[model samples]
Target: MFAGSNRLTIDDKGRLAIPARLRAQLADEYGKELAVTLGPECIEIYPAPVFRTMAQQIPKIADRAKRVLVQRLFLGNAVESEIDGQGRIGVPPLLRDMKALGTDVVLVGAYDHFELWSYAQWQANNTEGQTHYADAFAALAVP
Candidate 1:
């Protein structure tokens, strides 16, 4: 049920604090365990339980090659992590470097998980739907 966005920062030590509004939901429902990995255009964070469920799907992909590729890209790069008492989570150096995310950031609540995007990257990809809205809504069959 996670939904919405927050502007945040990764401190020099590379920790980002979850907003207080979402902190309790995460702590109470998900516990401290977490998994982080690089996603298509941003870094992804998932509760350990949720991540485990996704990991299990890797072996079920019908295509052998695609399954293997996904395993390596998703599972291979995942880093186990947790939220600290101060409510901050450590962003793995690898994922941070890969996503160029050492500064201001955008934390987007994706139904079951969260996405961390570099501020610049977010701005670049979040252009107003001036050009793509029609195709996008059409694809989703929205009226």
Candidate 2:
């Protein structure tokens, strides 16, 4: 499971190095390939197998609605990438633009997946979301 946060920089070529610990986990499960996709407010990185499972779950619907939703979310922007020998993956142009990724980014481990966020955007998101965190945990408490 991926867990913890790391601050990383995108190189001039727009490549970010996966943290060594995370890289080990990915290597064990996926060899070196990963799937990058647009997430709610950031970019999601998935080990190939996990990505495949997710892809398979996209419901099959009528041609009209299915094409719009599935194509936009699954086919429209997903990029398949391979981790380089040095353990870095290049963020594609479209994904970077979608997330407004700059030089500094926050890599957040999200259990089975990871998310990449621009440093500034992450700060804003965390600040806004922190207040509700206590409520979320409290709701889960055993009555």
Candidate 2, residue 139: lDDT: 83
Q: Write model 2 residue lDDT over 1-143, tens digit each, in one string.
A: 88999999999898999988889888886778899888767899888889888877675555768657776876567888899989899888888987899889999999898999999999999999999999988888587
Q: Backbone clashes in each candidate structure, one number apiece?
A: 0, 0
Please report, as a residue range, the 10-residue window in candidate 1 with the lowest summed lDDT.
Answer: 128-137
Residue-by-residue lDDT tens digits, candidate 1, 1-143: 68998989999998999998788888788888889887877999999999999999889999999998888888888988887889898887888988899779999999999999998888777775447867776787556
Residue 131: error of model 2 in Å? Answer: 1.5
Give candidate 2's TM-score.
0.89
Alpha-carbon RMSD, each predicted model: 2.0, 2.2
Residue 123, candidate 1: Cα error in Å is 1.0
What TM-score would each prediction reach against the true structure?
0.89, 0.89
